[model samples]
Target: MTLGREDQPGAQGSSIQDGERDSPSAAIPRLETGIPRLDYILKGGFLRNGTYAVMGPPGSGKTILGNQLCFERVRRSSSARCVYVTLLVESHAKMIRHLSGMKWFDTGMIPDRIYYISGYTALRDQGLSGLIDLLRRTLRERRGTEVLVIDGLESVEQRAPDVLAFREFVHEIQGLSALSDCTTFLLSSTGERSHSENTLVDGVIELTDQLIGLRAVRELTVHKFRGGDYLRGKHEVEIQSSGMVIHPRTEIQFDTPQASATEDRKRMSFGIASFDAMIEGGLLSGSATALLGAPGIGKTLLGLSFLVEGAKQGEEGIYFGFYEPPPRLCEKARKVGIDLDTYIQEGTIRLLWQPPLEHMLDSLAEQLLELLRHRPKPRRRLFIDGIEGFRAASVYLDRLPRFLSAFTNQLRMLDVTTLVSEELDLFTPLIKMPSPELGNVVENVVLLRYVELRSQIHRLISIMKMRESHYDRSIREFFIGEQGIEVADSFRSAEQILSGQARLLAGLQDREGES
Candidate 1:
């Protein structure tokens, strides 16, 4: 029998053993994550004594996230000492008060193990020597210190006198972390600022806020992590009274190994009997469906229909109107035979006005979180009107996709069937196409148009795409009425149904025969 090069009979086993030792699985180590969902993202946790950078915009919870990690070490008793060095505005007592509000400060035991020292002195003095002296004293005590959190590295930059000193100070701090044998978390508020700290750290986490209209949807991106394999992409996260919580996104793939054969367990009906029948017994629960149309169409009315159905089913519903205020929408729904008063009075429906567009993404996500927190039974339906209202309100367009993905996934996880409406009358047909950000996330899309026949414009409804379901391609004639929406037969002509013109196919055939 012929043997390969590595498998020769005389070859020593040491070389073959070395190949197995270098495999990917062998490199993985079990780690303890200081933060809750953070461990899940770290593929266990950070390596011991590694430096990590946490960055975000102002009021984006960077300080709170760092505090949670510092307190976590205290709880585990892995460290007899944990230090928090802050240079931002708040004093030590005020900072402790805020951390206490999160319930992170249990009054019982181990409070003494946690320490907070003001870094303003070193920052104001503009000397690395003062900072080094403070660090040496803290580290020399040797009380089994395990974690150290440094907040507002930018403050040091302000007083370092020059860029060279600032860079040098950061380098020394990295060296200090290694000498102390404690994992250090450095916080920075980085937007347009130029800082080399991102390169100096062992790991870097960049926080981004995407504005949908006026909403700042916060996301975390792990830019670099040495000696670890982590998820790449912007991830949704929220800061609550409980501290930092990660809203992870699950990309449902049928081709993957764990795809379940059974569909989701929950199901809910859209209120319209005819429409529900058209959709084969209404939309599945925890899935997303988009209703697209020009203004004056029944998109909002359809959203209310689902809410009414949810109310009847004893399930909760939230109606967020971006274009229409709640009072006006409720009044209109009343005229259309959907007495929202009944649902509101019964605590079955929640009507919320569109939040400021500057933080539209954040507001929408926070609304869902609020509902989940207050209503533990789970919401059955969510109706978002004027999703495109955010376009005019958004400062950045690229951020919309990540925001929508986060919002849709949250709804799906809650087992809520979401109905989203997009207003199409504002732009011309060519420019008004659904941006790719929204086109791919939703499961079903329904298009409503104003079609002209015989010189009279009539409303039409067409199923654009229905994921995993069969839908009729023909556009059905529809109307807004006192009894809500009504669907009619499809237009029989073929010249141009949606445009302001159409010619009868039968009439054209007859004319050709005569010619």
Candidate 2:
């Protein structure tokens, strides 16, 4: 969701005058972390001079995030400096070596714009007070330091003589942060938290990596942002060589502008003239359509035809397929007499491929949104070849409905006419929906199935639902050949086409017997 600067008050870090306390001009001064998505989640960026806590279990990416912020700060501002103090016994050299692999790491900033110091020995030998003294001295000497990151808060907690001492240490750092106008990040690998520690920090961010049925998913949550209305939820985070990439969940404002009358009146062809006729002259321009079918029922071919038609009509589209790579998809399309490779080469179609396993739903949404942002008005059509891919990617199956709803809403906001293919279980006699949630979010449903008749299996297509429009209800026979999909004539003599076992109608049988 896009929140204008006015929707949120300036961060608490900004000093307020008595007369201008409620003035709109008193916006919070922000310190950009250089992580675009994270900044967006924070309602711009972190509050300048704020003391925030980054809490997580070991290897949950606290260190990587802190280092990334530091490197980005120094890279952006030549005068900006950061002090990275570690209370763990890990040597500075080892830490630097680990960071050197990250894209944000800058060796030239070391000992100058970014200072790495170890407080492990002092904290171990002299306790919390010694660590506090070290920080005080560093802040005093480095007056220009704009940021301070303590990489090991747990070390001080372990060495503290008592809870009071640990609380005192946290308080001292918070005071120092306020006095020096330096944004501070305290990284702790502790699962346990103290009330005083939470109370003293201006904000708290929690990172987690947990196994969800053999796959580990990493997430970040904003536990508290004292003076900011940060996006609230568990945001997906991926740690790559470039550093942390946070994808806030898709949140579409309810007040988003409705589609223009012209946009609503427009209809998009599925590249098949007969199919368009069934759907009352094609799908509504910005609507989401679901193509449901069993395996080998030509769902993929239909989706490909739709995309190819859009491309042929001079419309840009995205093919987000989970099963096949681009080259394989192109080869398959060519066999049907459609050259997907040509459209791909001409930049009319952007193909995105994702493997079936260990995929994040939010990541896919973010990728689609990014593509739309770059392509803008001309990019109108989107074909997601596998709906089951999202279902498999979801850790919580129950949230699938909500996620799909929000995702489709976002697509609608971008004015994309989306078609999604869902694979139903094969050999089932009944026509089962791939997802019950589809009934709510999808504006139209197209059903494809194999119907057994007279010892032969024939493919049939029907329009199940068309919201706000008239559509042909007849179940038509279709075939896939070198010329692609062809729909012709309804099964006039058949009954129960949806049951996967079509039987001749009694009237047709009687007439045939008389003949």
Candidate 3:
């Protein structure tokens, strides 16, 4: 690690005071990690001159995460330099080869801006002293070294004579980082190591790649961050071709909305006059409505109608679904007298169909919010075909309600009027919501159910709940035909309509008894 370089700012003998914790106020500066949403969760980024531990299982992506931060440091700033010292047996060439496939990896920056070295030889021969000496020399040799990553901290800990010796080594590393004003990341596997290294560090980032059922979900959490604030909890992480992406918990990310909807004072339509009349005009602008019903009961169609009508009124809209492909979705909409393809071609409407596969809940919500944020027009309409798709993809079932609440709040803040379809049991005598919290969180809920009367199945539509507004409470028979979705007169001829069976009301029953 010897490069007979000229004098650098922190070349082992800097004039800056040792053990300088960041300033007391929020004015404490940050060293940006350049990872999307990660910085946001970090409340800015890592504290300047902070030492953090990145711990996880062997295949939990800790290695890639360290490398990504190193490369990003150099790419984001010209004067930034990084040293990646691995104490593992893996050769530097193999690591570089693996990283080359990632979009951000740059070979040209190696050895110059970013230096990779093997610290195993020194650690094995000279023990802790030898490793510390090598790191000091690397910092002195590489001018402008703002970032240093010590990968495979476990190897060094294994070589430590005892926990006391390992704690001393950890203290030495922290001192070096603090004195030199360089952010340091110590990478190691997560477990009950017999070392007090965690207490000596400025922060701890723990990653977990757990197999829940058949799905492998990766999550990240920050256990400790000194002199800095961050969103606490397990955030979803994914390793893609572009590199590592951390999706902060949706509920936490948008706990408070960015902006409010402009249509709060007015109403919007669904292109069906009778249905609009049923809702007293349309749903309140920028409100979320749960369109609940059983399968094959026109939930998706009705949600699409909401977006289609918005598009027709010169409002931008999106049909974000997971069950159908875009072509099939457009075709289905057209079959029900909706010119969905035309609106899509005109750019007034978009069909975003994500296949029903393993998906990160935060990632799905992030994408939808991103699209809504960049729309060309305000008061945009969004219809999620079935939220059950998200529920199926969720690794944590209990998080859906809160996640949906935050997500819905975010949509409203973006001035987007969203309609999410929720499926009930195929047949049931009781009216129940799969997510009871959803009914209370959203501003409105429209119930669509199937009723069997005289050997016929009739589709019924009614507004179950509406807040801050008035709506027709009568349950009406809705039909989807060439004339489009139409809501006719109420179910005046039957009782117990919601029980999946139609029965004669008291008056009619009395007449039958008399006969």
- lDDT per residue for candidate 1 within 232-289, as digits (tens), equals 6656666666566654333211012222212545456766665665676777677788
Candidate 2 structure quality by residue, lDDT tens digits, 1-515:
00011111112111111122132323888888865477766766788989999999988899988988887787767678889999887888887787777666667676877888888988888778788889989989999899999998888877887888888898899899988889999999976544457778999899998887888988988888887666687888888766787777664212233444234457788777788888877888888999998888898889888888888999888899899988888888899888788899998988999977688777777777767866687448999998888888777788788888877876787789999999887777777786989778999999887766676677778999989799999988787888899887556756766666667776563112210
lDDT of 1 at 429: 33
Using TM-score as the yardstick, the better of models 2 and 3 is 3
Best by lDDT: 3
Q: How accurate is candidate 2 locally (lDDT)?
A: 0.78
What does candidate 3 score in Cα RMSD to the true structure? 6.9
**After TM-score superposition, what is the CA distance of residue 18 in candidate 3 from its true location, in Å?**
29
lDDT of 1 at 292: 83
lDDT scores in order:
0.65, 0.78, 0.80
In candidate 3, what are the lDDT values of residues 374-493, reduced to their tens digit?
A: 554677898988888888878999998899888888777777888989989877899989888788779999999887765667778889999988889888888878757888755575
Off by over 4 Å in 2: 1-26, 193-195, 251-264, 506-515
Order of candidate numbers by TM-score, starting with the best: 3, 2, 1
Error of 1 at 383 (Å): 2.3
